[model samples]
Target: MSYVSSVFQRIKVRNANEPEFLQAVEEVFKSLEPVLEKHPEYISANILERITEPERQIIFRVSWVDDQGVLQINRGFRIQFNGALGPYKGGLRFHPSVYIGIIKFLGFEQIFKNALTGLPIGSGKGGSDFDPKGKSDGEVMRFCQSFMTELYRHIGPDVDVPAGDIGVGGREIGYLYGQYRRIKGVFENGVLTGKGLSYGGSLVRTQATGYGLIYFVDEMLKHNNKVLQGKTVVISGSGNVAIYACQKATALGAKVIAMSDSNGYIYDENGIDLPLVRQLKEVERKRIRSYLNFHPEAQYIEGCKNIWSIKCDIALPCATQNDISLENAKTLVANGVIAVGEGANMPCTNEAINYFLENKILLAPAKAANAGGVATSALEMSQNSMRYYWTFEEIETKLKNIMVTIHSNAAAASSEYGFGYNLVAGANIAGFKKVADAMMAQGNY
Candidate 1:
């Protein structure tokens, strides 16, 4: 192998414990192989290693009192990976699956995702092992308050900005921001994003990720002189991202035939009723199987993986990481999928990604495609700083523009490297150049 490849292999060996993080770095490096060979300065700087490792990692205890007056504690973490562009910005996830490895991987991906937004935001990710799934509202509030009690000390307007991820949403943000406000009495709106509308949340913050996923896919289609109109689509995960993706697909004249949750997937050969989906998932907090009760024509499969076999023109994996594997990807390609936009972080495996790329499918990586969430969070921060709230239409328009700009930037980057229409190369080269230039200016750290 060449020297650049050798350096990456060494770094991968040294950081073998973080499979997801290594997978992310490998994808970018493979796409940048040509550039690395041309620029010996990059190899000499060892920029890849510096860029991969977080500058600061903070892990703390979050002990809270439940409604039973029982005491519980969970681990919380914040990995500030890089700040070459601006202040550290990312989401805080609260789920049982969280750990140091997951946090680091998310943080590393956030670095490039934020960079693609073309917004002045850095990279970080944090959250707790505090599962809010079955807890009472009171219990969740107490846990969020307790979690933010310590987190508030570490975050501020200029220091680090945290938003919502997996298990953290409007409810969690409300509790956390309330506690932060009560403790500091400053009412700094930019400190936390994904807040309630009245409390300074951006109008489209809730819809950004899913809508942006569609926007990116639309761009991918347009790149090939195609569009989403009259296309059949299948989306995994019926949470915020999945629900919104369904809505946007319908709005774009695409028939979203299927949507799934952790338990299973619901397929309606006819277009999915996003309104009913919102009722089942958002208001009722139930599984996707229940949707069959409303629409008997819809079929419910008992596993998420089965959704991939459904024939479709486009697919958006908006669920958790590694939800799609080689087997599923092969099935998708065989079924004639033209494009995929990842709404969830690292939703597909390395093998699956290569399969898609090699097949000439339009693959929009999570860092470049699903950046709508963080980009809207940054907008929320701006609104918070100004103590002003924007209308839903206004925020939605701005969000659309941001996604279009990101698509243009990635496309331009791909063309610059003579890898026209290759989004992976575009994102890696564009994101890496920004962070590397900043690090060079800062000297070290």
Candidate 2:
């Protein structure tokens, strides 16, 4: 067997129950055959084995009291996957779906995603099983305090820095940072990336991922002698990533017709009202179905998955992992989706990705396409370290430049390997080579 296949077999056996992690590993390994063929020493040095395993896995019990005065216990985890480039960096997701396997999957993906940005940050992921959906502010704050009390010890400004994901956002980051400050008694702003502007938060951080996804897509289109202008875009999810993707795409002259939430999706043929989306989501924290209250002319779909059936020039699945199934991919291709960009990590399943590739749909993989968030997070870290901030225009420009570079690099790598613009393989090869070289240079830890 080839080295890549051999290593992946072992990973599957060891992580048999971890389907998400297994899927992530398999996706990455599939693209690594070319790399392994060229660098046989990597196999001898066991770089894949070491890189596949996390440097540290932290699991802790978080005990807190709810608003009803009842004590609640939740599990927290932090998988520091790799740090060859720099400190362990990723996000803390606070959903009930969070588990060891999910954290491992996210952390594993982060290793490459961070590397694609060409940033001096490694990959790690953390989260708790605590669902903050219906929790009161007091309850959430108490839970964050307890969670951070354990997490703070394992992270530092120059160590492992975490931002936000799924359930963790500006509010959660504030609570976590406040607790970390209370514990450490120091103004270590660089320890967190998604803080509020009143504190040390960087401008354009919230819009980075979404804006970055669109920017990368724009670059992909430009490479194919196309542009986002006049394109009909359908983006899944109405959170930070989706919201800003809509904003940026609309600004770039694409008509964003649809956006979604966990509950359902909203379709506005006249293009999504960016301000109203911001109002409904960011301000009111309401369901996407509530969008109809203002834009009565718009259609409200009851199921989010059905949003993929809408015909559009571009499809961006920014919701969650494995959101786009094979059926969704078929529907998109049948409806003539010219391009698909993963705004969420592993949003497209392996089958879905294959269908897209087989149909010759232009695809921007998540690692290279949606890397804007972490890239901006790294920018935030730099500003925090310098105790200074850049203007929104300046930060956005830097983010655009980075996304363009990532797209070009992935395209170049794909062309070099004769993949004919297979960004999936290109991104994997590009990101893995960097981490692999760094690991080799550092020797065995």
Candidate 3:
């Protein structure tokens, strides 16, 4: 067997129970065949083996009191996958779906996603199986404090910095930060990102991922002799990424037709009402079905996956991993999708991604497209280190530039490898090359 194939087999056998991690590893490995062929040094150094194994896998018990004063215990994980480029940097997801396999998969993907940002951050991911939904504010605070009490010892500003993901957001970050500060007895804002603006948070960090997804999509479409203007967009998920992507796409002259939550999706033929969406998901924290209360003319679907059936010029999947199946991909192609930007991590299945690329749909891979949040998080780290912050416009301008550079670098790598428009390979190669070289320079760990 070839070196890539041999290494992949070993990983699959070793992580047989970790289906999500295996899927992530297999996808990146498929793209790295061409890369490994060009750089025999990578093979000789055993970079693949070392990169596949995390530097440290930390699992701990988080014990907290519920509102009823009953003791609740949850499992927490922190997999510092790789730190060759810089300090380990990723996010902490707080959802019931979180587990070691999920954290490993996310951390593995972060290795490339952070590399694609061209920033001085490495890869790590942490979270718990603790569901934040349906919990009282006091219960959430207690959980966050208990989670951080164990997590703070394993992380620092220049060690392993974590931001928000999925269920963990500004409120969770705030609660965690408070606990970390209380324990350390020192102000160390750099240990976390996604903080409220009053507490050394970057101005545009909240909207970074969604806005950056649009920025990358705009550049990708522009290179393909197309524009987002007059395009109909269907964006899944009603979280931060989806909301801001809608705002920016609408600003860029695209009509966003559909957005969703886990419960359901709302389709508006008159394009999405941005303000109403923001109010519903952000302020009200309600299900997407609530949209029908204000706009009776719009249609509400029962399942979130069915959002892809809507006809649109661009499809942005901002939901969770494996959200789009091959059937969804086929439906999108039949409906005339010209571009698909991923605003969430691994939002598309490998099969779905292949179908999109096969049909020449301009695809912005998740690692390259959804990197805005982390890139801005790294910027937050820089500001915290210097004790200074930039204005919103300054941060937004820097973010747009980074997304454009990522696109140029991915496209250039694709063209160089003779992969043409296959940005999946391009992004993987570009990110892997940097991390592989850094690992080589640093020697074996």
Candidate 4:
């Protein structure tokens, strides 16, 4: 068997129950065959094996009191996967679906995604099984305090820095940072990235991921002699990523017709109202179905998956992992989706990705496409370290340049390996080679 296959087989056996992690490992390993062939020393040195396993995995029980004064227990996890280039850097997700396997998968993906940013950050991911939905401010704050009470010890400014993911956002970050400050008794702004603006948060950080996804997609279209103007875009999820993707895509002249939440989706044939979406999701924290109250002319779908069936020129899966299955891919292709840019990690399943590739749909993989969040997080880290801040224009300009460069790097790697714009393999190879080289140079830890 080839070295890539051998390493994957071992990972499969060891992580048999961790289907998500195994899937992530398999996806990354499939593109690494060429690298393994080029550098035999990597296999001999067991770099792949070492990189597959995390440096530390912390699982602890978080007990906090809800508004009812009853003690509730939730399991929290932190997977400090790799720190070869610099300190461990990633996000913390808080949701009911969070588990060790999920955390491991996210952390594993982060290793490559962070490398693709061309930054000096490593990979890590953490989260809890506690669902933040419907939780009061006091309850959420208490839970965050409990979560940070344990996480603060394992992280530092120059050590492991975490931002926000699915369930964790600006509010959660503030609570976690506040707790960390209270516990440490020192002001360490660099310990976290998604802080409030008054307390050293970076501008454009909230819109970074969504804006970056569109920027990368714009680059992809440019490569094909196309542009975002007049394109009908359908984006899944109405959270930070989806909302901002809609905002940016609209500013770029695309008509975003649909966006969703866990409950359902809203379709506005005249183009989604970005302000109303921001109000419903960010301010009111209401379901997407509520969008109909304002835009009565728009259609509301009862199921989120059916949002894929809506015909559009572009599809951005900004929701959760494995949302686009084989059937969904078939529906999208049948409806003539010209391009797909994943705003969420591993949103497309392996079968779905194969269908898209076979149908010749232009795809921007998550690592390269949705890397704007972490890339901006890294920029935030730089500003925090210097005790300085950049204006929105300055930060956004840097972000655009970075996204363009990432596209070029991925395209170059694909062409070099004869993939010819196969960004999946391109991003994997490009990201893995950097981490592999760094690992080799550092020797065994």
- Model 4 Cα lDDT, one tens digit per residue, 1-445: 8777877899899899999999888888878777777788988889888989999999999999999899999999999999998999999999999999999999999999999999999999999999999999999999999999999999998899999999999999999999999999999999999899999899999999999999999999999999999999999998999999999999999999999998788889999999999998899999988989998999998989889999999999999999899999999999999999999999999889989989999999999999999999999999999999999999999999999999999999888877888999899989988998999999888
* lDDT computed for candidate 2: 0.93
Clashes of each: 0, 0, 0, 0
The candidate 1 region of ten consecutive residues with least summed lDDT is: 31-40
**TM-score, per-candidate, Cα-based:** 0.97, 0.99, 0.99, 0.99
Q: How accurate is candidate 1 locally (lDDT)?
A: 0.88
Clashing pairs in 4: none
Assess each prediction's global lDDT (C-alpha) against the native.
0.88, 0.93, 0.93, 0.93
lDDT of each residue in 1-445, candidate 1, tens digit only: 8765786798788888888778777777877776776666777788878887789999999998888898998999988889888889999999998988899889988888898888889998999988998899999999888888889888887889999999998989999999999999987888888888877778889999999989888988887899899999999999999999889889999999999998889989988988999998889888889998989988988989889999999999999999889999999999999998899999999899989989999998888889999999988888887877888898888888988888888889889888878887788788888888778777855
* Position 312, candidate 4: lDDT: 98
For residues 181-232, write the lDDT of model 3, one tens digit per residue: 9999999999999999889899889999999999999999999899999999
Candidate 4 error regions (>4 Å): none
TM-score of 4: 0.99
Lowest summed lDDT across 10 adjacent residues in model 2 is found at 29-38
What TM-score does candidate 3 reach?
0.99
lDDT of 3 at 225: 94
